[model samples]
Target chain A: MAEYAAQGKLPEVLFFVGCAGSFDDRAKKITKAFVKLLNKANIDFAVLGTEESCNGDPAKRAGNEFLFQMQAMTNIEVLNGYGIKKIVTTCPHCFNTIGNEYPELGGKYEVMHHTQFLKSLLKEGRLKVEGGKFKGKKITFHDPCYLGRANGEYEAPRNLLEKLEVELVEMKRNKSNGMCCGAGGAQMFKDAEPGDKEINVARTEQAQETSAEIIATGCPFCMVMMTDGVKAKNAEENLQVMDIAEMIASADDL
Target chain B: MQYIPNILFIIALAAGIGYFTFNIRKIIRNIKLGQKVDASDHKSQRWSNVFRIALGQSKMVVRPIPGLLHIFVYVGFVIINIEVLEIIIDGIFGTHRVLSTVLPTGLYNFLIASFEILAFLVLVGVILFWTRRNIQKLKRFWAREMKGWPKNDGNIILYFEMVLMILFLTMNAADQSLQSLGVAHYVEAGSFPISQFIVPFFDGLSEGTLMVIERSAWWLHILGILAFLNYLYFSKHLHILLAFPNVYFGRVVPQGKFKNLASVTAEVKMMMDPDADPFAAPDEDATEAPAKFGASDVMDLSTTQLLGAYTCTECGRCTSVCPANMTGKLLSPRKIMMDTRDRLEEVGRNIDKNGEFKPDDKQLLNDYILPEELWACTTCNACVEACPVSIEPMSIIMDMRQYLVMEQSAAPQELNTAMTNIENNGAPWPYNQQDRLNWMDEN
Candidate 1:
């Protein structure tokens, strides 16, 4: 994100991340890296503290329309008043809501899920990655529904994975056929519906079958679900779920 | 009570049969003019849906008041057919033994008594149906949603139904009178309380008068059935004929996926380079014209979709499950199908009668369905999943979105920004392409 700012290719904007932005120790490290990037480039930004609202993704899904509209409008007013024309969110739910769904209430702005924005910066010479220091890392990409089907942007994160010297093992049902992370439709906040297994747990099993070292995805919601899935299947030691952003931040700097 | 009434029933029966036959033929021709329904790969005879929907009367069972009433009326029709045959045979041949041989004397008399009782129940049911439709004015009725030729059709059906009910009752009254007068004999007459009550009126009637009344009653009842059948085609009650075939041909699979796009010839030819492997490069883009990816108008729909619109029983089951509708969003899957049917009928009427179809003349997009309604859909399969008939509303919504975005460039404003980001940077963010791997460099 800083590299793009350094090159004057990306806009300078305030960033508002959701609670899952700082999930665990590993996520904290990646968030620091992002902050470090911002500091190095001297880019202007602010993180929304606990005051950041839920965005009502859960309420909207559960048919609680009253709460969704109120929460949406509140966020809209706050963001619009702040003159935050562009919002970069680590959470796909936040990105999809602010970018896609909020427009119905007359709140419109430029929004990007972080991987898409980061992938773009990598494609341009504005950001350079030192590569090939560690080779033969077998990796499989998980397509988050919001990033792929709902939004129709699928290829950039895959290309970024390839550029990171990661072996890109394609899933059989990649792209539009990608399975949900069991977090969509606000399933993340509430207990899952009655079923023999969680969808994410099933998806993680699909990933583990690939024998990849790392399970990489774009959305924070997917990150949380996939991680829980890995734990549930008792494959936490054998398998791992990491956001593509965190993996990219791990690359050996030139 | 008199021979004149029986004579009137006979004349009415003859006229009703002829009237119904002609109308049914006309409706058949009109429906046949539409596109042929594509054969479904998943289709098989569903005896259960037929049993539940037809004999069990489950669709009507949704509204308890009407459903219960209609059940009695429907069962009445089914049971009375035997009585109808009996009456016809008795009036023509002066013998009742033709149908009575199928069962024992006691059972036959029981069925006859049951039919007479059921006929009275049906008469009361039809009167209530008419009264409810005209007086109560239930807006949820399928007839209320209809436009064009069917605007006043609910009343017409009501009138027809009421007349048939009257004929049924009067015919039963004449039959009871004759049976009581000993003109028509049963080996074991069962308890027909209403028939027994009306029987005393014809005690002293002349033999000629009793015979004439019986014959006329039989004729009137038969003619009423014939007229009712003819009227079924024109009324919104056409669903009676269309629903069976409609349900039979309903998409067997869940309605979510779009029709497989035809191959493009240009892409096929382009792939024929020396580097091409036939197995790897299956001919996908062989489309010659800009294929209608989604429906832009009524005729833009595939024949299966057209059948879906007509097949909808207006059950509102789709609406009940639709997330958009649940969220107070403008998109109601049921309403979409209903509107599509209305638009199709309107367009067909204009084209066939006026010899012109100009979509511009009608604000079809805004008036029929707004852009907001189309966009509100999350493309969830909930509506399709819930629908018993498997009508795919999502495909229709997506197709229109495609046309709006790809052809007209009339998508929401955020799409413009997203597309720009994609076009210029190959991602949906205004960031340098080089920074795409920034996160990889840090760890």
Candidate 2:
């Protein structure tokens, strides 16, 4: 893990596989790429697979502090037992908890959202992403509050998208001020308060106003919420929410 | 001859004493009910924050026009206490203009003029605060959250302020009337400007009528302060006194961390002792009896956490800064404090009246704060960071989370599955634990 970071290679990454990211077989393929990339770079890492669980984010928010801490302590002990020092994850919820919150439970680690790792791979020239011949598609990146404000990571996904030659348009509220997808804090798993307009719906409307073909983001939570927003607005035909890696892997501008 | 003045002075004295005593008692009761004090050292290092922010009216300074207005009122309000003392003195002696005997002509005039100007500023400041809370025009800042004051509370404070201003104006008018009619100097005769304006109207008035107006204004002014002091306890304006101590003793470290679990002694009181049929232990007994993970009630919070709620100015800055709240998550940091306060208030009443302790029900989430809102928090310290008063909303969320996850073992299905996976395989998947290293090899 230490050697990989020093060489600008992927570290001994522990992936936080969340429920949303777990059900899809495509998740395996996406993670398989991550594993292949780390292997090619000779970085030491492990995937906790089903062994990696929820980071008690939902429990904590639900006023279940005991469950939150128990899960937190359990994860911390497991990570330490495995001698894991760094983490890379597809799920922003897990990523935020392990990196930002675990320390509060005496579990400190270098945790990165997967886009951060991929961006590092690109920066190191270790992973060659094939961008086929295509015109630059107008894309607006939705900054996930967890990855962006909570964790202060706003550039990795955008940098990768820019490098891919995608036309990047910004919503009125971007970066730290980015609107929420109404999927955070376990809202993805529960019904929201009764209101005519939902937050994610508002955010999708903002994305629609941007007139972008794709809403690219780094976090899976954003992907799910934005997708829901798109579906609700019936704009799925016009705007697509794609993860940065998926965009890079399939960009027409490549 | 002085009996009437003496009677009014007795009333004012009684009111002020009674009012302050009642508020102090209420504050103590609230504190005892679990308004916390953050043991974190951050508060002490910035001792000047108390004076600068609360006393100096710094937070209000963010909006200069309104800020300046408030500062004027606050300064004037404090300075007017001196005037109250003089009123009390005169009421006792049945004589006015008592201060004129000690102070130079210029000094007395300066004191009165300064107070008058300060009073004017205070009136303007309070009007703005009032309008900001009630009018739709200031909705840009006030909308969507408790921006300034709740409607009822704001109105009460505004009433106090108006009374104070009215008393000041009426007394000045009455004093001027008496002075213009060649009344003997008791306090400085030329000290009041409004009094000068009323002097012409008093030219034909009898001395007795002038004296009656003077005494009436004095009574009103003194009575206003007394009422306000008592009302401050119940009003949102409690921040006036609470903000100082809250800012003075804020958390020292980053607000994310919870206090370390309390240490237990050697005699392990295990309900699951195999010798006593471990598996047969009831759910409640299965866990440690004196379990110290989550806060079951208000008293469970540290002294500072409780204080944080009281000290909160309902600025909505916390809600505004919260990532979860911004993203449309149910979590509103401002509402969390408010709810805690509401619950704390109830808890205080329950303990005082019945001494009953009820286990927090699972519905606490749905009732106190929605489950979605509670789960929406990323444990980010943005709310903590944005708070000018240093209230750590995240800590409260985190502590409650600890209780739900650890004690109840009732978390979301996804989180439960994930946690189980982590426990059995060191990862979140169904694969062999050793294969965890395969990803590293492949990468």
Candidate 3:
């Protein structure tokens, strides 16, 4: 944000590199793949560099409203300072909080989850996917609660997945009635509540029921959860949990 | 001689109305224990919501089988109450069939015929409802949350309706018998299509015996209604009366829209303004700190939320659809609403006993709702959408979570670490902010 303000010119969009995107080992690969796609597509975008902070979605959902407000206010000030409008993020938690929750705190912007942004780019012919490596592979998409139910953007992720030329199977529970991967509402940061089964395990079982070779997700938190579920079930070697961005970047050979 | 009956009638009326009024006052006072909120917006929309959801039974019918049965009971309960108006008037004036005299013969017959049919339908509906709860054990009604008082309370209301309907039918039956015998003041008033079948039970009885049965049934029916009216204050049956107002004041925003606190927003706005002074004295109104953030007790919640607690029907639709609950999590959305109502009642009792709320070491958090249940919630709006009366259990869960984090500084350790990372490095990971752009180099 500081660099963009210094340049006195606006990029086409600001990429909000979420926490997982910035630091988590697995999620960094998704960030790199998406960044590669942007570069290949010639879409001018800039990261906030050190100016970017947590979108505070985790804090807010975890019930630390005060901390959430503090973080959101700081980010809003920087974004407004640079007059940034459109934003895209790899995490649905950030996309949801900034797109739906931020407007109430006076941080209005046109925010899109990365899958939505990728789908839009594909539609605009700025990006193309010929399924270079994933041709005819059977993949199942896991709907992150934030992107699918919270914001009703189920079509965007599915549409992007369809471009990979894979056999896109769906779990029985999908879209509006989709089950949570047990990572939402800050559950990702807490021990599982006492129950007969972990929610992620149940959700992963549903994905596995499709007998797909790949479990594709649109959010970093979901990727973490589905990966954990696959490891728990000892199916890591046979089945891979991946983000849509990683698939798209690999398909484009970027 | 007439004065004695008139005096007895007055006493019954006074006792019923007085007891009902006292309970209503207590409920109002308890609900007022909550903080105030502005549900005064979107008047027209609120009215339509009440009409659609509460009156029209729109949301209830989402599941066809039980939904249709509920409509029978709902419509029966409402339409049967029209007969109560006549009962009230008759008790006061020592008159029989007052409405019959007030309306033409055809209209009176039509009303009586309709009442008889609905009374029979209501009887059947109540029976099916009872069977579903006790015999068939519908999973929703038998969930872990519905275990003790909730279970008993549900059965009690069904039994109450059954007894009332039986009394209504028997009263009509006895009156029908008296009319056939040409007894004076029998008046040949109502059409006893349902109760006609019951007339045989009164066959061959003398005038005095028949009169006794008819009068006693009438008295019991009215008294039962009065008792049920007061019982609502203690029962989940309170939804019978509150569902209307609750739906009227339901949340109008999109399900995903979370409301931001004004005070927090104000502080943030000040910090964001580049031209503003940083060390200036705060505004006079902003001097006082908010009375703890979020809600740890009934007093911290808004009046509308308290109302939602009281209006909860404990139907378990919210729990049945909840992703957390479905996956076997400890969280049950129905239990959240029930716990809130129980805590609110406890607070009300405290105020009633001491003339003000005494400092009870117990609170809504940790006592009624555990952190496990709170943490298990996915914040999916399924609970809110599944509620027939528009109760938002997720809101209360979120608010209590806010209290746990803000007031107590007690969050799960993983969350604490993540929050710490966000505070120090501007993200939820322990990484240097300068290296945030390194993902680009990997490509």
Instruction: Residues A187-251, candidate 2: write the lDDT tens digits.
Output: 55555654456777788899999899988876666777788889999987888887776665554
**Which interface RMSD does candidate 3 score?**
1.7
Off by over 4 Å in 3: A1-8, A28-46, A114-142, A152-176, A208-217, A235-254, B3-7, B104-107, B139-145, B189-193, B267-290, B323-329
Candidate 3: pairs in clash: A54-B426
The estimated TM-scores of all candidates read: 0.51, 0.70, 0.88
lDDT per residue for candidate 2 within B1-443, as digits (tens), equals: 63975886787788778778875776577666663443455545667777776677665665477667767776887897777777778777766667766678788788888777777677777877777766745532454555445656767778789778867876787777665566775333546654456556656778888778776777767776777777776666667678777767665542423344432111112321237655554566454555565654567677777788777767676786554565555678888887777777766665567666454453234467654555666554557656666677777776676566666775667766655654455434455554543443342
lDDT of each: 0.60, 0.66, 0.86
* Candidate 1 lDDT over residue span B187-227, tens digit each: 32445655566667777777777667755655655665666
**Per-residue lDDT over B1-443 for candidate 3, one digit per residue giving the tens place of the 0 to 100 score:** 87786678779878988998998889888888888878889999999999899999898887787898898888888998889999889888888889999999898888888899999888898899899899999888989889898999999999999999999999999999999999998888877788989999887899999999999999999989988988888899889888988898787765666777776777667766888898887577876765578888888888888999999989998898887888788899999999999999998888889999899999999899998888888786778878999899999999998888888887888989988887788877678888887776664
How accurate locally is residue A26 in candidate 3, as Cα lDDT from 0 to 100? 88
Which scores higher on lDDT, 1 or 2? 2
Top candidate when judged by TM-score against the true structure: 3
What global local distance difference test value does model 3 have?
Answer: 0.86
